[model samples]
Target: MAASSTTLTLRERWTRFVDEEMSTFVFSTGVYAAAICAKEYKELQPTPQRMQQALRKTGAKMPLITLSCAIGIAGMKMCILGVSRLREDYTRSSVLVACPVAGALLRAHRGPRAMAIGALSFGALGYGSDYLFSMWHRRNADAEEVRYALSLREHHNVHHNDAFFIETLQSNAYLLEASQK
Candidate 1:
């Protein structure tokens, strides 16, 4: 029995590692491919370059854009992590509270145009991803076979603050504080 349990754990960990690696690879590849395609299509405005020239210029921008996107995403995630640590029982709604503050700071450093674009993209990316994850989990939870198995799944520690998803981040400013009961 002990040997079987140990083998199960090893298999679970290997599955997780493979899944993570595949997802990372797919995401990076898709982002780079999209960026390259967009740039080539944009440059086609100038008398439609030969296929060779377009292909040559295409890959050059992809790497840079991919790196920039990775950095931006990492920075945003870091900020979200920081905010959750600062507040108790942080939720997705709580993160929205920091959007305006971020916008203001960005506006001051950049400009209104940048702030507007950044705010829209940030809001969409953050909330959309959260919603998608929730939907995936909900689907799993609703499955007859998964319900029983879920209990055996490992859960991450919630020592600092328990983060949850809410439909909107624009909930009342005092909501977190008032929800202690």
Candidate 2:
């Protein structure tokens, strides 16, 4: 009986891992496509014809919106998988990224000065809330899937803000490398 139970557990874990990885891939790709479309739309300038064109382009392009939605769904799935696996490292990293982004958004919506203070305050609060909620959900629920999904949602929020950071980091690294030459 014990051996059979162990085999079942192992099988379950494997399945979950596979599902999560698939989800991560889809989510990442979708977000990338969506971001590209958004940037393109923004660059076109706001006119009735341009707006209609943008909408048509996005709607007609299967690869664009479909990829984004797939990515989002996949991310949520991966989060659930992580939580179920009790992977604290992944969860913590996710929280780190999510908290600051949430704060920044809150700040941005409030204007310049409020943006700074709001970012700090909201970021801390967001992180704390995430931690507490994760803990609570883990204890109270049969599965931590919902908690994991929420974490992934937080991660998506951070992902949206990551473009500037990524670009800056790449530029700085290039400059440093050039200086050393």
Candidate 3:
């Protein structure tokens, strides 16, 4: 009876930890989405030149962003490991949680019913965990690297311009063909 109680206590603690971590992950993803939206909004504003200049200076913020990404990745890895262990130890409950969570993490888009359920479930479980983990890792390792990454993102955005895309496509084709053996 004592052993059983200890086991139950351990399981409860694990569940609580998972729940908290998952919540943090979700929050981080929401932040990332918000950041992306803000970038888009800045691009659309009348004073986009200032925004563009700021983006060009993003190299200064690289460390923060990189650390965050690293943390997010680590968190996701931990979540996967925890879920796998839980599934092996407690098949039914783990299935109930892990299946949907795994599906969502993978962004699986199968049939309508499965997709809808998986998306909603995974959205809830996987949340922004990955993003947060990665971001945290990047921030800790190289604060300045984030600025460069942001600049890269900005450059990529400009690549979406029709003229730029056309030019890039032509150039890429030439390079690819030229490099062929």
Candidate 1 lDDT by residue in tens digits, 17-118: 566554654575576566566656644455455455656776765565555444444444456667888876678765764554443333333467776776
How many clashes (backbone N, Cα, C below 3 Å) per candidate? 0, 4, 36
List, residue by residue over 1-181, the lDDT tens digit for candidate 2: 4666446587787797676666755665565456555655744566776666665676666454454345434444554445646655565566555444444443343366755675577567867887887766544452343345445556676676576656655565554455435
Lowest lDDT sum, 10 consecutive residues, model 1, at 164-173
**Per-candidate alpha-carbon RMSD to the true structure:** 16.3, 22.8, 20.0
TM-score of each: 0.40, 0.27, 0.28
Task: Note the Cα lDDT for every prediction shown.
Answer: 0.53, 0.55, 0.53
Q: Can you give the lDDT of residue 73 in candidate 2? A: 44
In model 2, the runs with Cα more than 4 Å from the true position are 1-38, 41-46, 87-181
- Model 1 residue runs over 4 Å out of place are 1-29, 42-51, 94-116, 124-181
lDDT of 3 at 31: 64
The residue-by-residue lDDT of candidate 3 on 9-38, one tens digit each, is 877877976776667656655565456445
**Residue 148 lDDT in candidate 2:** 52
